[model samples]
Every structure is written in C-alpha cells, then in structure tokens.
Target: MTDHIDGALALSWMNTFTEDFHAAQQALTDLDRQAGDGDFGTNIASALRKVVAELPTADDATFASVFTATANGFLATGGTSGPLFGMWFRAVSRSTATEGTDTDLLAQGVAAGLAKVQTLGGASVGDNTMIDALAPASQALLDASTGGLTVDKALTSAARAARAGAASTADLLAARGRASYVGDLALGVEDPGAVTVAIFFEAGAAALSA
Candidate 1:
C-alpha cells in the first residue's frame, strides 16, 4: 500500500488542483454567461487562490488541518460557492486527517465531502447542480475500491464519472441555485457548478497519482 505521502507532494497537488479549478471556472463562466451570472469563473478562481495560499507548510500537518485551513480560507473569500466548497473541504479534513496518502482514506474523505454537498445543497442526483457531478464521482470511487482498484485508478474513475455527470447536466433542467430562475432557459447548457466539481475530482486524482 502507498503510505506516507510527502508533504511537498501534497502541496504540489493542491497547487495543481487550484489551477485546474481556475480553468474549469473559466469554462463555466463561458457557458453560464448566456443566461446566468458571468462571474462564476472569477468567484471560483478567487476562492481557490486563497485556498492554495493558505495551505499549511509543515510536514506534520494533518489532512484535517490542511482541509480546515482550506475551508477557512475559502470561506473568508465570500461567494455563493464559498460556503459550499468550504463545507466540502471541511468534510474532507475530518475524514482523512489520520490516513495521509492512504487511498482508502482519500476515497472516504471524498464520499464524506459529497454527502455534505448533498445535505447542504439539498439537491439530489440529476438536480442540475454540483451534486450531479459529485454523487457519481463518489459512487465510482467507492465501487472502484470494492473492486480492488488502486488509488490512482480509483481517482481516474472518479474523474471520469465527474466529467460524465457534468456533461449530463447539459440535458438537465435547472432545479436549484441561480440557474433555477431561468427554468427551461437552463437546458442544453452545462452547469458551472457541475463542471467545477469535475475539476475538483480531476485535480485531486492527479495530486494523489503524482
């Protein structure tokens, strides 16, 4: 089993993940500007930049501590996505602090984060929200683990699921958040939140695999 992940590697992954999130946010901004706020990209990027900057540097820093710092950092940035993303990170911190680079711990942390998103967002699968991407990714990670997949493989599976889920949102009707206000106008457009969630999984997987 891959244990004892280096702190510098973890930090590098976080930085890379932040960059991926900015790219995804830009895509969402392009997609949503047709009917919703054009600021989604800026908002997410701003929040993630703060997350990256605030990450703890100590080799002994626990996953929970890092996650908590990420959450607190993002929360301070202020946005609709801020509290939500912060909550997810908070869940990750709580679930994975003791396990470090352990694959099982990472999977469990992601599942916990997904559950928190659902609870906080009150949006289920196919809701045309971040949950759309998050739910599928979490399930995929869990399934892959049960099948004896490696951590890197499981992360890849989750990233694929997240992308598929985000793409599926293009056919879904809006049911929550600002997109809901547009109703039918929301159809045929990819959800910004879903896309960003996919990016999150992709970044996380890359970090762990590296």
Candidate 2:
C-alpha cells in the first residue's frame, strides 16, 4: 500500500508536474502548426503559470483548496484551456476532499476529471480531443483498482493507456477544437489536447511513485 499524500506533498507534486505540462505543450504546439492553430504551447504555458501562482499555501491546503485555487487562476488567465483545466481540477478536488491521496483516491480524482471534461467539452472517445487520452486512462486506472491492483500498478496502467490513447490520435480526424478546421489534414497528427492530457497523467503517475 502507498502512503497518503498530504497537502504539502500534493503542492510540491503539482509544481513539479507543471514542468511536464510545459514540455507537452511545446511538443503539441509543434505538432499543431502542421495541422491546426499554433498557439497551444503559449496558451497552456500561460495557464500553468497562473496555476503555479494560485497554488494554496501549505498550512491551509487541502486537495480542494489547491484545486479551487488552480481553477480560479486558470479561469482568470487561460482561454479554453482555462475553463477545461479548471473544470478538471475542480472535479478532482471535489472527489478527493474526503479521501486524501492514495491509489484509490487518485483513481477517483482522475474519474472526476474525465467526467468534467466529457460533460463540458462534449467530447467522446473518438473525438480526437483530450478525452481520447483521459477517458482511456481513467478507465484503465478504474479497472486496475477493481482488480485490487496497487497504486503503483494502477498508475502504470493509466500511463500506458494515456500514451496509447495519445498515439491512437495519429489516425483520427479532429472533431472539435481548432484542429477540426483542418479536416483530413488533421489525420496523421496527434491532438494537442490528447498529448497534453497524457503528459499530465504521466507526470501524476511519476509524482505518486516518488
């Protein structure tokens, strides 16, 4: 069994994970220029910067505290990524408030995030959006939990699912976001949102493992 993650650890993890999001944003922006708008990197970086600024002080922090701070920050500073990321963090915050952070808690948090994204974005599995990565990663974590897998094992599963989901986008036609405007040209390229979601999952998994 893994130890519970407290407010301090969670805050540290989020700050560290921000770097991964930045890298993923750059990668996605590079990909996007070939098939869609090229501003995803700048947008995600800007939102993450706000998220870092809005993180709660360690003394008063709870999962909800951190998430709500992130949500408010993103909503203020980010465009589409703001609302979407804010919704994800808000949902996860709601789910994790009572549970703290454990393998099961993490899974629940991811599930909450996925539900928010689906509801807010109206994106399904094949939509070539963040849902492509998040839905599968959430389900994989859930399945691992159902099988009584350890936190480490479940996180590994989710990471694999996220990566596979991101890769799968290579063949998908975009159905939402700016990429959708490109039609068939969007095929053979990964969705920036999906790639970024995968990066987030991977970062979370790594942080938990640490």
TM-score, one value per model: 0.88, 0.89
> Best lDDT goes to which candidate?
2
Compared to the true structure, candidate 1 yields what TM-score?
0.88
- lDDT tens per residue, model 1, 1-210: 334334554666567778777656656788878547777778777787777677887675666666777888767766677788888877766655345645566678778888887888899987788888988988897897688777667777999999999999999888888888888888899988888888877886787766
Q: Give the per-residue Cα lDDT of candidate 1 at 29.
A: 88
Poorest 10 consecutive residues by lDDT, candidate 1: 1-10
- What lDDT tens digits, residue by residue, belong to model 2 across residues 85-162? 778877767656454666677779879888877888888989788889888999998898688787656777888899
The lDDT per prediction is: 0.76, 0.77
lDDT of 2 at 117: 78
